[model samples]
Target: MRVVSLHSPAKVSGISTAGARLSRLPPPHEPWTPLLIGRALTDEIVRDTPLHDAPGLALCAWPADMSPVGQVLLVRERLRELGARVVIPNDLYHGFVAAALDHHRGVRVGAWLHAEHHDGDELFERCAPISDAWRCVSERGLARALRVGAGLDIPPAGEICPACVEVPPACAAPSVDGPLRLVYAGRLEKHVKRVMDLALLADELDARGVSFTLWVAGDGPARLDLARAMDTHIRAGRVSLLGPVAQHDMPALLTSADTLVLVSLSEGMPTTVMEAFACGRIACVTAGCGGAVPLIEHSGVGVVVPTGDMRAMAAHLARFAADR
Candidate 1:
C-alpha cells in the first residue's frame, strides 16, 4: 500500500504548501520505492513525500493545471501501475480530481474542500459520488459544504501542527516614528486574493496621514495592473513589490513586517495568516473569510474587518499604529 497525493506544479506556491502543512507526514527510517510522475510536492520536495510502507498513508501528488482530464487520467493509470487502491486528493483550490474519480470509482477516494464555495460551485459535491470520505480544512467550511447536501469531514484546526510551520523571527510592535511595515504575500490573482484592493487602501492610508510601507510578494498576470494602481505609492517609497521571493526567503521578509494584511474576496485557512502568527506578527484580515476568520479571532493575533471596506481597514490600521 502507498499513499499518493496529487496536485499541480502551479499550485506549489499558495494552496499546495498549506495542504502539505496540514497533512504532511515524516519520512520512514527504512528506504522505500517512492514513485515520481511529475514535479515534486511544494514544501518538502524530498523528505516528506509520504511514500511510507503503508500504502494508505503514502501521499502521491500530481498536478492538473493545463489539462485536468489528461492529468487526472494519467494519475489514475500511474496509481494502477503501482498496484495502489486508496488515493486521497486535495480538491480544495484546483477542482481537478473529478476525472480521476470518474476513472477510478472502485478506489477508496478521500476528497476534501479547502474553503466555502458558491451555490453553483459544488466542487466537493460533484466528486462525492466517487469519494469514500470527505473533509474540510475548517469546521465552518465543512458545515457550509454539508449544507449543499454533501458529506464533509470536519476536523480540528489544531490538527495542523504549528511547529511544522517554517517562519522567521517574531516582529516587535511599531514605534511612532517608524512607518508601519505591512505585507501581502501569496498569489496576486484578483479573483480570490483581490490584491488590487491593497493599492487602493494604500492611497487611503497615505491620505489619512498613516505612515506605512507595504511589501507585496509573489507574481502573476495582475502584476502590471497592481503596479499601475500603486504608481504614487511606489514613487513615494510607501509600497515595494518584492517580485516572487522564493519560499525559503519568505520567513525573513515576513518576520520584519509588523502586520500581515490580506483583503481577499474569499479565502480558505490561509497559510500566510498562520505564517504571520507563527512569526508573532499581527494579521488584519477580512471578516467571513473562510477558515482564516477563526485563526485570527481565536488566537487574538490580529483584527478582522468587513470585506471590501477599505475605509474601515484603513481606520483600523491607523488606530493600531497610533496605539503602538
Candidate 2:
C-alpha cells in the first residue's frame, strides 16, 4: 500500500496545506510518503506535517542535482527500493515518467489534474493517455479525462491521494440583502480569472445606483490592473482589495459576505464556490469556471454567466441587488 507522489522544488509552499488535507483522511495499513525533490525539507514543513515523526512512516526528499531523465531513473529506482505500489505526478513529463515506471516495473500510475481548459486541450492529450487513471479534482476535469478515454477511477493509493470531490448536493440558503455584500476571493489575474469583468461589473452596478460592497481578496501580478480599473470604486468605498488572504482566514471572509463573485475566463472547480455555498453565500461565477456551472445549477449554490459578458454580469448583479 506504499505510495509516493512526485513533486517539483516549487511545490514546497503547498506542503503544509497538503499535509493538513492528508491528515484528515484515514491512514492506510502502510504509511503514505510524499516524495519531493529538494536538498532537504525545512523544519517548518516537517512541523506542519502530521506524519512527520510517525513511527514507521516518514517524509522523503531527494536532492535536486540530476538531469530530467536521470532524476526519473533515480525516482523509479527509489520507488522500487521503498516498495511503492503507486506513483502520482502533477504534470505531463512526470506522468510520462510514472508511465515508464509502470512499464518498466509493476507500478500504478495516476495524474492529479485540477484545471479544465488545460486538461481539455494540451494537458489531457499529452498526459492522460500515458497515465492509467486521472485523479481529477473537478467534474469538468473528469469529463475532459473521459473525453481522452483515460481511466476515471483513482487507484486506491491507500494513503497518498488527491482530494477529489463532485458537485455537492446541498447549499446554505443565502442571506440575499440591501447593499449586497459581494466578494471575490481568488487571484486577481487578467488572463485566467478575468478580474476586469469584476471591475466592469462594479462599474455597471455603480452606474445603476446599486448600493453594494465588493471586496477583492487575493494578490497577484494583475493586482495593479485591478486597482487601476477600480480606483474610483475603491475611493468611493464600493470596493476594497483585502490583498492576499491566508487560506485559514478564508472562512471568515466568505462568511461575512452574502455572495462570492468570480468572473474567471477559465478554471477548475474553484473552492471559493464551495466555501460560499457552505456559508450560505451564492457564488456568482462565469461559464469559464468549469464544473462550477453544473454545481451551481444542481446545488442552487450559485449562478453562472458566460465569460467576458459584462452586460450579463451587470444584469445578474442588478438582479441580486433587486432581490436584496
Best by TM-score: 1
Quote the lDDT for 8 in model 1. 41
The digit string of per-residue lDDT tens for model 2 on 1-324 reads: 666665443311233234333433464443345554434667665543433433333344556676667666666666677677766665536535744556656787766665677534566566655566667666666666666654433332222233422233444444556578888977667888788888889988888888889898876678898899899999999899988565556667777778888888877667667666656678888888876788888987667888888778778878877876
Q: Worst ten-residue run, lDDT, model 2?
A: 157-166
Q: Estimate candidate 2's alpha-carbon lDDT, on a 0 to 1 scale.
A: 0.65
State the local distance difference test value for candidate 1. 0.64
Q: Which lDDT values do the candidates have, in the order given?
A: 0.64, 0.65
After superposing candidate 2, which stretches have Cα over 4 Å from the reference? 6-20, 27-67, 70-84, 95-99, 102-105, 118-120, 149-178
Best by lDDT: 2
Query: Total clashing residue pairs per candidate?
Result: 15, 0
Q: For residues 78-193, could you state the per-residue lDDT of candidate 1 as single tens digits?
A: 66665545555555322235334544445555565565657324666566555666566666776666677534443222232121366554555444568988999877778777
Task: Provide TM-scores for the models.
Answer: 0.76, 0.73
